[model samples]
Target: MSMRFGSRRQGRLAGAGVLAAATAGAALVAAPTAHAASVHVVTPGQSIQQAVDASRPGDIVQIMPGTYQESVLVNVPRLTIQGAGAQRVILKPPAAATAQGGAPKASTPDTPSTAGAASTPDTPSTADNAADVTPATTANPCFTTGTGICVAGTEGHRLKGVRIQGLTVTGFATYGVAATETDHLVVAGVNASGNKLYGIGEQKSVRAVFVRNHAADNGEAGIFLANTTQEEAGALDLDGARVSGNVLTGNTMGVVLRRVRDMDVLRNSVTGNCAGMFVIGDENTPRGGDLTIRDNEVSANTKYCAPNSHLPFVQGAGIVLTGVENTVVERNRIEGNVGTSQMSGGVVLFKSFVGVPNTGNTVRDNMLSGNAPADLADRDTAGKDNTFTGNSCSISQPAGRC
Candidate 1:
């Protein structure tokens, strides 16, 4: 009996020892690692891409005052790229001579190739000649065509919390700024101009804000938001975008939203483009929900025809809503949208061949004047559900009085 009792006691002690060993191992495995944030200052002669490559998440890349002839691609989360000032910090493509050969000519002192890795701000940087082998064209496939700044993400790898501030991005081959499948992004106080395509392009992205920026002289729209679809369900995720307090001019369209939802376009000055704004719906991607356009100064957008562009020339229009539903246009100063075409007007609504009608749209209490032919027009066959009320305009089409 004594031997049996001693064996039981030893057995219980062995079980307790095993459990304590397991607990100790778990505590070691679950220990947290330290993540330190870093600040990398990029001077005139340092390569921003090299700085980005050395950075982890939650790092700041500060660009000093100079012209950087390079395209940047940012895929890291919680990353901040700040410049000294918009006009002082210029990010442009390499000169055509440098871009063609993918090497610096050694004649230009400011080439991006001569720019080395990151250094302190007190250390003056050499000019760098940029190459295409870096992160320049490494955006999403939908946004790979652009050359300025591309912020993108892939499946299972979502990037968020990015801020781009106080930079002048210009003279690129395509879009000045392209954000694809990203979220919580902010593009503020930047001047994006003279690109071959959109000044700022957001595709399949959500919760993006564009404020206090200037977009001009782009080959396409100043600001474009589209939902280019993939085979998966919910692939086109264009939602919760706010475009306010910006100046859009000298593009094909100032602002264009296709298949976007819950958009607010307010307090913007859109002028001197092909069309001030366009909300289009088509068969592949249907129109989205709850668009509000108010308190904008939309004028003088009569340059509707351009070469090598596919947008139909809709003459003399401040805003055009086609095949859209549940939209509101109010309190805008729309004037001087004059053209010889019969379809030209201050605010026009039309239908497309997509079979979805423009229903439940409200055009009310807008200040309109000097618009040629009319101040408002409804050319949709299924335009019965739309309401036009309390508009302060001289002339309206389809025999309406407001």
Candidate 2:
């Protein structure tokens, strides 16, 4: 079944203003300071944390090529932390620290689940919900928090204009990189792998960007964004947050955007995992939606994952959206994914665990092949105003959708 999707020129044209505003916001964050910013360089064997601590707002902390052992934290605003390159600069746990293994899981205030709802044996609670290592120190909270790098801010004083780039962070117990209550944050050209949970994660943040990065071999989602991991809450407006030009593989899921709105997931290569992408929402105020998933290559996500409290075992799922409204999925290349789970498909609209159905979503112009169950699966019969048109696929659930 081959059908031509209608032109989206009007939508693109209407969104130009929003894109411009987001670009301007990013520029303002990256603009040069009135006074020259200081640069602190750290070589191998030096304490990166010390350098970071010494830095003031708008300062640059440059890490030289070498393997370093220490967790770094950035709380100051307008700070730039850069490395020589992802290959040359590596951050791991301290030598005395024991290596933590197995997949990382997340426990809500009321219920427990793995990151993005995929799990395996020996899973530990995620950084946000888990207790810190013994003898946790206030001077460097990240040291015992099991996070390689953490940008932390309270709701009253959000961290703003922090940039992290060109580094490799791996082998941590929880997230390789994490941020909370942040604004105008940027993570670019980094490699985060071998972590127990998310490679990179952000919660309660807005106007964030993740670009040109590689995330692999993580136990959970390579990149995860959410409103709050600690408790159930309403979705947050992301102010045009974006995930683009990244390679995500060998994780439970490539990317998970949970309870967030006004975001873009574009031009990503996702494969070799249980699922490629998940857009999850629930019965809450300002339900997650108004996002775009476009121009991505998703394929061959055949890794098996065990069932969690929220979801059944998921494999070969390209993109799954639940309880979201007004979301657009278009112009993606999805193929070679095969599984029997209800969520498995090239593009699936599934019912939310809380019984909320998808609403006003669109799936169009995606090329799909070799997907089991069905390429286009509208599993949410109760969903409202969901449309499937202009797709190039041979099979779809309930027939005639392709």
Candidate 3:
């Protein structure tokens, strides 16, 4: 492995954790109140949907060990869906909606699974590649395409306190676990893999805690946080989001934070993807920042989405900051991110938007090595007030900056 390091003389930057906590606390003030207590037990071959339909706010739906082939949407407030264990309980899409049930759909000509210009001669062609295709915007892709578990709340009814734990969600056309316009949600110890889009995705949600989860081998991002429009973002708390102790790999991006704020992404293992954590914002409404990315192992992000995909055609990076501000990257192990483009590196800061350059960001005290092009890259002239201090690296792409 070719290792390169870049930095000026180092000093300790304090209160990173404290700032993260304070930011998270400020965002939680808008969270809804608690719900009434109720518990419902569901076994295999029984209708989990029926149990969900009968449930009220603050109800706990405990599921036993079995393969439940149904797409469940949780709209009830404060609903807790707990399985026996991630390995014991499996939630798959229904047979009719599954990609494997009928005639194999042909891969898109531009898809990575197909014989594209970028595809190697030895690339194995398979029907499983069809699972990675993007779904339409007019419908709920989970039902139309397929999804394992979804916590959906409309703009009028913003669901609160929905908790999902100990479940393995796989073989879905859309997301394995998805949520929108919800609050106070906890997704723990879940294995979300082999899904079409993201392994886990949340849009316009608040106070979410994703802990001890494994999100891998998805088509898009492993864990995605998106706020596309202001109306959708308005329903979110934007306070504290806790993403920790998770293994994210084999996806377009490990964790994608777009137009999200006040998040703490810590102690996670992110690797073998196109890019690790991406903190992005733009000139549009509800731009995101205020993140603390620390204490994680981020490496070997060497995959990219197809050119025809809706996602940006970004290559490997341990972490990327674009059009974002007031963010911190500290105390992490970052290395080995050689992408298709020369911009690939351990960490990259760029101005993704025209007027809104990435500014007021700090890259401090990170252990970076073995990254191609260089360990650190400052790729935009618009990026201002950015500081790289105390990072233990040998060189940067631009010579004198280090």
- State the TM-score for model 1: 0.78
C-alpha TM-scores of all predictions = 0.78, 0.85, 0.78
lDDT of all predictions: 0.67, 0.78, 0.68
TM-score of 3: 0.78
Model 1 Cα RMSD, 1 decimal: 19.6
**Which pairs clash in the backbone of model 2?**
none
lDDT of 1 by residue, 186-239 (tens): 787677887766788777688888876778887667888765422212224446
lDDT of 2: 0.78
Q: Poorest 10 consecutive residues of model 2 by lDDT?
A: 1-10
Clash tally, candidates in order: 10, 0, 7
| Candidate maximizing lDDT | 2
Name the weakest run of 10 consecutive residues (lDDT summed) in model 3: 4-13
The sequence of per-residue lDDT tens digits that candidate 2 reaches over residues 1-402 is 111112342233223323433553465467776766788999998888888888887787889999987767789888878777666788876554543332223342111123223223222443542432322223433322667888987777889988887778887777789888899888877788888778998888999998777888887789988887765578889999999977888888899988889999999889988999999877788888999999999999989988865457889899999888999999999998889887898898888777788999999999999988889999998999999989999999979889
Ordered from best to worst lDDT, the candidate numbers read: 2, 3, 1
Q: What TM-score does structure 2 among the candidates reach?
A: 0.85
Residue 202 in model 2: lDDT: 86
Candidate 1 has its poorest 10 consecutive residues by lDDT at: 108-117
* Model 3 alpha-carbon miss at residue 224, Å: 0.4
